[model samples]
Target: MRLIKAARALAGASQDELAQEAGVSRQIVIRVEAADETVTVDAVEKVRAALERRSVVFIPSTAERGPGVALSKTG
Candidate 1:
């Protein structure tokens, strides 16, 4: 993913280094890059924070709502 690549480049960090900083194992970072489903939200957040420290912008995904539609359900 671009996020992973950007994090690695911005920190001048290897997978091992970024994994350590993000409190995950090198294998986890590799799996995440490979788009493995096993990666957890906590791990993603840690990696995102590490990238954010280097001024990388992380834009989270939001549900696609049609125009004039509210997310919440109302009676």
Candidate 2:
């Protein structure tokens, strides 16, 4: 949830923009960022895909660090 919020913020994307990009509803994006348990995995994946398309690279959490996102160099 935190990662998604950060990605959108850094990408300068509004919820409506993300929703359009993900082919989901703005409410779904809202629920996702809020960490709502009812948000489906499919919806989350769609949002992730959309972020990736916008050059948001998701980083895995290692023992010494937390999960985070970075911008792709090509973007």
Candidate 3:
């Protein structure tokens, strides 16, 4: 995932370092960076946490946003 690599770079962490921080193997980082489709949620969350620690903001895309139900402002 570009996000992972970018976060790792931003944090000045090597792949191995990031893997260790995320409690995963270096291979997992490599696979994730390569956009492997089999990545797990745990791995993604780990990377996300690592990025968040470095103040990396992750905003959900519009497509990934919830259904288009409107919210009442007075609620």
Candidate 4:
């Protein structure tokens, strides 16, 4: 989805880099980013974790920020 691709960009990671960091295949990253089909939660979590480590934050929808991803301020 857009969120995944944004997070990858925020992390300065290519699909191959994200896949390696998440212990998944580059195709998985591509499929996820494209939202072409359903992917497992575990796969999403792995990709999320990889981005989080690189200072990407997944913001839940709220009264303020809304739902999205961003570069962590602390980073």
Strongest candidate by TM-score: 2
By summed lDDT, the worst window of 10 consecutive residues in model 1 runs over 66-75
Tens digits of per-residue lDDT, candidate 4, 1-75, equal 899998998899999999999999999899889886688878888988999999998988988765898898898
Candidate 1, position 62, lDDT: 64
TM-score of 4: 0.86
Higher-ranked by TM-score: 1 or 4: 4
- Stretches of candidate 1 exceeding 4 Å from the true structure: 59-75
- True-structure Cα RMSD, model 2: 0.6
Q: Residue 8, candidate 2: how far off, in angstroms?
A: 0.5
Candidate 2 per-residue C-alpha lDDT over 1-75 given as tens digits, one digit per residue, 9 for 90 to 100: 988999999788999999999999999999999999999999999999999999999999999999999999999
Candidate lDDT scores, in order, read 0.66, 0.95, 0.69, 0.90
Q: Residue 15 deviation, candidate 2, in Å?
A: 0.5
TM-score of 1: 0.65
**Cα RMSD for candidates in order:** 10.2, 0.6, 8.5, 1.7
Residue pairs in collision within model 4: none
Best of the two (3, 4) by lDDT = 4
The list of candidate 3 runs beyond 4 A from truth reads 59-75
True-vs-predicted CA distance for residue 3, candidate 2, Å: 0.8
TM-score of 2: 0.97
Candidate number with the higher lDDT (1 or 2): 2
TM-score of 3: 0.68
